[model samples]
Target: MSNITVCSHPIIQQKISSLRSTSNTARDVRELVDSITRLMLHTVTADLELTPTAQEQTSPVAAYTGLEISTKLALIPILRSGLAMLNAASDLLHTAEIRHLGLFREETTLQPVEYYNKLPRTCSVDQCLVLDPMIATGGTAEAAIQILQHWGVKRIKFVAICVSRRGIDVLAAKYPDVEFFVGVIDEVLDRRGFVSPGIGDCGDRLNNTA
Candidate 1:
């Protein structure tokens, strides 16, 4: 079964609420997204394995044992909305590689169209975290995941600010082995394939184009 973690952190909830408001400026949206991504990542990476250092580390005044992340990680942010969360994810996972996957939804079909890919020919990381602000119809997310899977990624976790029920259901059913960490799940998707009460074209909002 797919593991879905809906963030319940008070700060995350408040930020999501702020994001949903129509009055927020593009700056407000970007700041809020940065904050939310940092907070949510704490929960998303909590279970990552750690390994003790080969030798004790010396502090300013004393020596102490230290541990480091044992698993290698890669951040795959689906552009251009996914780029909004990239800095926050990078700040948290300082050593992780950053890759970009560009996908867009066709207006008529609501299917994903890929125009850019930066993944290596062979997988180099132990786990991959896909970043996208919203998952409405799930087409884009599914397409991004397919690319990663095809590149030989064995573990993938999707991180999103919000998701629609239809989106999550589609992804969960199709990629049961993958995990999801999202701020909230809205129950509706309008006929136009937009999540009801969602942040509304996060790419446009982030770029102040909407």
Candidate 2:
């Protein structure tokens, strides 16, 4: 599980607790999700490569070397629910290309069904970050990762608010080279495949669809 990073920041924990409440309005849920994603961005991007550039500039009093991220990046947010986390990621990686991958879980099968994909014919980014609010059964996540890999993304990472133990295990076993950054991991999935004690139906909560 070395590739998995579970954030334990108190503020993130507090926000996750609030987000799980049934009492929050759609507005409240959206705000909490945004805040949590923003807080987690630092840890997710901590290892990005930086390179010195000749574009150095002088500050008010002193000259300083300019450094910039060298890796070409892309943000692939699974549609609908994943859109909730897009803003925070885009704010941090302002130049990253944005792509949408739409997938939904089949109620009876608990399997992922892909409905939309916006990737180009050939991969152009060095690293890709998959943004989704929850990893429930791992089916959807697995499908998403496979699509990205098929598209030729070499370095991939998944960022989410919550994940299930089962989901993490499934992904780790299949994609050992991939990385996961999540706020918390619940112990199990409910009978219907939702994460136990997880942020309930994130898309519904974010959009008041439920």
Candidate 3:
């Protein structure tokens, strides 16, 4: 398994830094997160395969062709805060299918339990990317990937705004074949399973708390 590649772009770092500031208002943070998510999507999807298609002009003298994605792609958001990132990914990948999975951490146990799940009728897509803002304990992400794999998603990508080292390590050991992309890899997970230095509870920040 490969390590989660933390985006090192200067612009991404600037936006992330803004998002992390305690002084940032909820609205500001929300916008920053969305922007960062869109930028991150670009980096993550850079390697996607595309097929060329020819275009005919009115003059019929000039040949023009554009590339279209070769493989089907799906985006599965793990719920609440994950839904926050979902919107950005959808805006960027307008043609990609969207799936939803609800997994919330049990406050006391820090274990994730699913409250809802809705997937596309088929998962034979060439690539399916799981979108979630945070991956701290790995429970939610692990469970999410299990569901996708069961649906026959052969190639999977995990995208998150931030991840705790322990969480990344756990996912690598458990799902070695899947690829992970993260904006930042935090130094540690706190006792409550929250990533230290992470932008507080993402769902809370997004006003999606239950």
Candidate 4:
């Protein structure tokens, strides 16, 4: 029962709409993605735990206590395209531990292969955010979630720019507790395993390969 959330924010809608057209250059795509990622993260991080602490001496007007996030956050951005979302996610959670996981799909089988992993030494956290721009086949997201589950993360959230019905089905069946937030559900997948009406291959667009 993966908790799925589709962003209805107008700002997100407008930003991502610019991404649908392939005419945009790599820099344009990256900017649009960063803006959309920040918008999506607002919803994903809403439930983060907080703790209040007393301040000894702070404001010039008066002294007061303040509340700060209590949860330890980890940002696991699947390699290549996920890297595009890192800057936005970092701005949202400045204190979070960032890890890089490199996974590429086997072109013939549509399976994910882990080529690199650099998780934090502790390998544990109160919350984890998995970032990937496209959710076409869902193999990569599932693999990353499994890794976080084994590391003892109590809460996990998956964020993407846009989703497909097929992709949502894969996670909803297996991850009832994980939260899924995407800018939109495109409702189709191409034969080559790409989300239809998507931003195209985000990695290729950002890295200028395509």
Candidate 5:
């Protein structure tokens, strides 16, 4: 089962289209990426658990629900490009706790391993959102989810700007309960481990690298 949810908003699609073009300047590309991330976050955080709080107003009393509880959701960024999307997801789910995990693609086999890990100590988390800009071969994502599972996270969701079919398949096969939220699903990975038709290197695009 391919459990990926691709955002279909016109604004998101338009901004992503701009990101796809090679002619876009670094500034424009960065801004488009930020815009697309914000939109994607809106869709991803729609059903977030919230706790109701009442406040007195001069006219009438009203209540609003803030993100239910601290342990309700955890945001884990897979480092580098994932850090870009992590900021947007954090902006949307302000109350959601953040756990930083740094994973890198090995030069030889592209397998992911932990360079840094700071998962939360609490084990009552209801859901966790993993942020990675590109899921080319599923190596990093699989390892990240596996780590989360070890830490007692029951529900997991992955958010990425683009993903390859093979990557999605690999993840689903490893962890069927995890859901993926992507902006676009692209073609195969190139020989260099980059997604074809992908927005160059997402980290480089966001950071204006050469």
Candidate 6:
């Protein structure tokens, strides 16, 4: 729990509330998700290594140093629904590289199954952010963190629009160093392994498969 930070910014809170509405259309849900993701990235990455970068430039009036971000950043968005956050995050951190991971859950076992993995053989980011719309069981998150670790990433953070307390505990017990930036924490999972009081199947809604 020490590593978890639930954003309380008013705009983030409002968008999250709108995002979870069952009556929301596909476009509305995607827009809300992207909006919250951008806001969350801004709020959470405020303290990232600035590096105090400056480049000398000749201005019309005088010579001055222009500032820039030198920290190496990467994003790993867990497939389909997670892809919704990728563009927003990219817009926030324009220099950050992106990687994709695909995992689907087994309805019967209620566990994650990795169907696609395209992580680079070597990653050189100072920090990596993993994006997922919902974390219900944490199995998918566990896999993502372990993969990043195996690739020699030093710092990793998991960001989600909604998380279940059970899922948070599961990830906390295993990877205390990995931070979590979440919009809201729902209580528990429903009978079907989905988070209770959650916006129904984010992937389905976003892709209009429902």
Better of 2 and 5 by lDDT: 2
Clashing pairs in 1: none
In candidate 3, which residue pairs get closer than 3 Å at backbone N, Cα or C atoms, i.e. clash? none
RMSD (Å) of each candidate, 1 decimal: 1.1, 0.9, 2.2, 1.5, 2.7, 1.5
Show where candidate 3 strays beyond 4 Å: 1-3, 54-61, 208-210
lDDT of each: 0.93, 0.93, 0.83, 0.87, 0.80, 0.87
Better of 1 and 4 by lDDT: 1
lDDT of 2 by residue, 4-122 (tens): 99989999999999999999999999999999999999999998999998788789999999888888999999989999999999999998999999999999999899999878999
lDDT of 3: 0.83
Tell me how many clashing residue pairs each candidate has.
0, 0, 0, 1, 1, 0
lDDT for 46 (candidate 2): 94
Per-residue CA lDDT of model 1 for 1-210, tens digit only, reads 348889899989988999999999999999999999999999999989999999999999999999998889999999899999999999989989999999999999999999999788999899999999999999999999889999998999999999999899878988899999999999999999999888899999999998
TM-score of each: 0.97, 0.97, 0.92, 0.94, 0.87, 0.94
What candidate 4 gets wrong by more than 4 Å, as runs, is 120-122
Mark the regions of model 5 whose C-alpha exceeds 4 Å error after superposition. 54-71
Model 2 spans with C-alpha error above 4 angstroms: none
lDDT pick, better of 2 and 4: 2
Model 3 alpha-carbon miss at residue 133, Å: 0.7
The count of backbone overlaps in candidate 2 is: 0
State the lDDT at 32 in candidate 1. Answer: 90
Mind giving the per-residue lDDT tens digits that candidate 3 earns over 1-210? 464677778888888777777786667767887888999988889888888866643446765666778778888888788877878988878888888899999999988899998876676578888988888999999998888888998989999888898899889888888889888888979898889898888888777342
Clashes of 6: 0
Candidate 3 TM-score, C-alpha based: 0.92
Prediction 1 TM-score vs. true: 0.97
Report the Cα lDDT for residue 173, model 3: 81
Check candidate 5 and list the clashing pairs.
50-68
